[model samples]
Target: MAVVVGSYSFLFVSTFVAALTYITYQLLSSYLHKWFAMKPVPGPEGTYLFLGDALMFKPKAGEFFRQIVEFTQEFRDLPLFKIWVGPVPFVALFHAETVEKILSNPVHLDKSFAYKFLHPWLGTGLLTSTGQKWRQRRKILTPTFHFSILTDFLLVMNEQAEILVEKLEKKAGKGSFNCFSDVTLCALDIICETAMGKKIHAQSDSESEYVKSVYRMSDIVSLRQRRPWFWPDFIYYYFGQGKEHDSTLKVLHSFTQKVIQERSESMSYGETGSDTNQGQKKRQAFLDMLLKTTDEDGNRLSHQDIQEEVDTFMFEGHDTTAAAMN
Candidate 1:
């Protein structure tokens, strides 16, 4: 009875809200058309809404960025032009100098609210952290990815690459296969091995549930960013809306916790051993660096901090590499 009542209430509220939005949109469009003086330039004719781009910006997944670049080129004749993705407004700059100025003025423009969608997964890690925290974390973590350290990681990368090549060889004479899935899996393996120092075979068909969860969580987060109907944090946490996101997070946390716990246990048992020295001296992965690091007060990072950073690396490293490969 409660479920039915709640469902009806939600339906009623959603319908009312949508009706109001339609009315407001019509009014706003009419007002802009009449009152605003648009300096016309050569481009496609239309206006866009702030959040309506998801509805009209139809480009293949991972190809939306390329489409934007193409659109910009097509309008290169104009110094500045407007394009609408639904009712949202976007001004494209054709001049290199203008873009350079915007890029250089880092302090003037803040990261877009779209970034907040990643906050739950990444926390205030280097990728999402700003100002001093970002600087300090970056400074501390930079050496971990240095050329020397990356050289050590190459063996892991090559091993994973070999696995992928073997898999592809099996399908060599086959008609066709999804190259995207293959690349995505390979990238996940690389990220897991390098970042966490764990040899997770996410490239395999029978990949860990944790690895699959990361991909699912990423998709949910990306969807929320593109079509933000409600506050994402609230929707993700409170509304039980993003069940996949929640489940993925739990699995990811469990995996990270297990890693940290095992590492901690090893450290505890070997009070003075080669394993401890090796962890201390040579080839520091991201997690190794995090384990060694201490905060301003000489306190170790909380478990939450380590988990967030590890998760961030997994998401950022895998997706960006996959997209680049594609």
Candidate 2:
């Protein structure tokens, strides 16, 4: 009787395992193979079930981006191509017409679903925002970037540029050191000053906690985006990526909150809700402008709203631009 019971249990477990495997394969293959057949543009062939090309980064983040670049060049003749980011298909276009068509369409203004991950970091600011709120926010923030305002920011830009050059001069002919790191620091410093009317001195203090967290958070977010298994919040939070993300958010948000509070307190003393320093006329920073400005309905933004925009611009302004320059 005991021998018979053991055999039955073994059979049941094996059957269950086989069924689960078969089901997963069928679901993965159905979409992948079907999409492969349907796509006009070429893409990675016979991808792994849920991983797509994500596994190619194994052993390390590896040369995954180089592989994509090579793939793009390999199919240079094609106007566009598809790439599966963990079963999610993205169409990459190289042709001017194809890019223009997508960009010019008002209907396609919605951000990609991947941007959902940014909600904790950026909130629903301009980059991730859409529909009515987006329209209203865009209207209010549009003039903040006007030519005259940007002209004021040029001095900040030049000052940061000079500091970068000074740093680079010391490294001249001192063997091969990473130039990307220095340039990124310079960009961060410039954006901090211009965006918040605060100087982070990131270039001088490269090991600052806030600066280090920014770089780490960038890596963490990129890694999370590439892996589909990490997409579900329950799984991500269970495995502790969520905690790391939250910790990084504290670093980023606290810094921005401090900047906003410092500026807010300064503005509180002024009847016009603006600040003056050392008896000299001070130019309004981005946060100051946002605080004084209102939406289409003439409603002043709440502290939460201002924080969202401040965090969004800080991330977009510094991180994206720095990475691009590097």
Candidate 3:
């Protein structure tokens, strides 16, 4: 009986070891092949089997975006180069021709895998959505931004610009207190009024929870992008950055959801069998337009869809205006 038990345990242990060895060998072999393939591209030679160029990435959140630009400068002679972060390959093209060749193709319209990082906050909105869903949403929303619609927004722009100038006037001689901040606040105010028809007064209330959460979320995203170790959702969450991220998302999404809920309650214009605003000639808010709008197939956006687009608009517009100002 003792001999029988020993033989059974030995067989089980051997089988497990053999399976593990085979799997490890297969993974290493595939990685070696991929590494060899990337060698043809002009990039840092003799890349490590695992870490790749991840160790070279800037540790600071602000400089995370500059890594690609620095690579371009360092490898100026190469029109195209590969940046390996861990086992992932980031192929960068410098020449306009190479970029246009890929970008100009409709089949390559899908956002890269990295954009999935934004999915938790942005959802499948236009900024991150792909395939048929993106096609349908884009078709529906594109007309909303026509020249005529833009012309209508000029009034909101002028109003916000005036407020921005006034704010700057107060700090005219304060000795360089980050004027970039003034621009961001003004941009936030403009987006809120123009898009949601609500005045968040972000210029004055910079310390608001929603505002802080937005900035925090932005920082967390940059940190996650550069640190490949944080790329896996399971590991990220296990370490609690994911929880922190979710907390920020909750704050940000609450604001958007509140805006959506209020907009829905106030107007029945887009919804079937709902009363329209008392026939007033008020300028349309972007949210109002989207609320009462439909696609070519008579499909109105779902509640979640509206929230995603609104949040995306807020995120995209706020950061862009700040970057431009700086």
Candidate 4:
């Protein structure tokens, strides 16, 4: 009886293990086959659900962008091509008309939900904002970037550029150096001085905590956008129970708050010399425009709003130029 009982137990365990394996295989196979079965609009055919291609798509970094350009060229005649970034669906367009339609109707399509990762940093500012709030903010800020205003800011830009050149000449006496790093520092300094009215010598002090934090956060935010599943509100808000995200937020907030505080103090002291109408006309920087503007209810901007905008510009102005330089 003991021998029979032991044999029965072993048989039962084996049966259970086999059943579990079958179920797992079926589930994985079903999903994988479904993903594999997606039709690629025909032009230049390539592997659709291959593991290599899926791995290539996830980070969507420089290499992924290059892959996209190459894929577009190979599939130029295809209307819509499907690529899998892991299990996620990535639809690509190779036609001008379809791309134009999407761009023209931003209200209908809107930014991808993946962009929610930016909410912690940008806080619905122009770059990350959508729908009616975006429309209104765009209208208000459009004039600030107008050709006339940009032309005026050239003087400020040239002054900053001169300082950057002076620093580079000092460093590159006769040895070859990395132009990429040098230009990025130059751009950062110019944007900080011109955008926030703060002189951050990013060229001389590459180790500045604020500057380093900005770069780190920018790269992380871009990574987060590519992985939508990881950006649920609760997880990002809690930062998965770690202090890294919290510490980065503190650094960013401190830097922005300092800029706003100094600007507010300067305005209060009447250092702008804009007491008279004519004096006000002479001042045309972003800060001056922000101070003069009012919200929808004719109420002025709150300190928080001003800080958000300042942070938005600082991140956008520098990172964009840096990417372009690279």
Which digits, one per residue and each the tens of the lDDT, describe model 3 over residues 33-84? 9888888888865566587888887877657667678778888877799978
Clashing pairs in 4: none
Cα misplacement distance, residue 217 of candidate 1 (Å): 1.1
Q: Estimate each model's TM-score.
A: 0.72, 0.83, 0.83, 0.71
- The reply for model 4, stretches above 4 Å from the true place, is 1-54, 57-60, 67-70, 73-88, 92-98, 163-178, 232-242, 273-284
Quote the lDDT for 269 in model 1.
76
Evaluate all candidate structures by whole-model CA lDDT and list the values in order: 0.70, 0.81, 0.81, 0.69
Given candidate 4, what's the lDDT at residue 318? 79
- Sort by TM-score, best first: 2, 3, 1, 4
What is the alpha-carbon lDDT of model 4 when measured against the actual structure?
A: 0.69
TM-score of 4: 0.71
CA RMSD for every model?
Answer: 7.9, 6.1, 4.2, 8.3
TM-score of 3: 0.83
Best-performing candidate as measured by TM-score: 2
Would you list the clashing residue pairs of candidate 1? 48-84, 48-87, 48-88, 49-86, 49-87, 49-88, 50-88
Which residue window of length 10 is worst by lDDT in model 1? 270-279
| Candidate 1 lDDT tens digits, 62-110 | 5666666787887676676655433334566759887787778867434
Steric clash pairs (candidate 3) = none
lDDT of 4 at 89: 55
How do the residues 1-326 of candidate 4 rate in per-residue lDDT, one tens digit apiece? 99999999999999999999999999789867766566433422444443314434546466657777887887776677666543455577668888787778756636665566667777878777778878878877777788876776666568767877787778786887767677788788877766666767887898999888887777677665554444565765565422566588789888878767767788778765122235434434576567667877897877777666777888888778877976
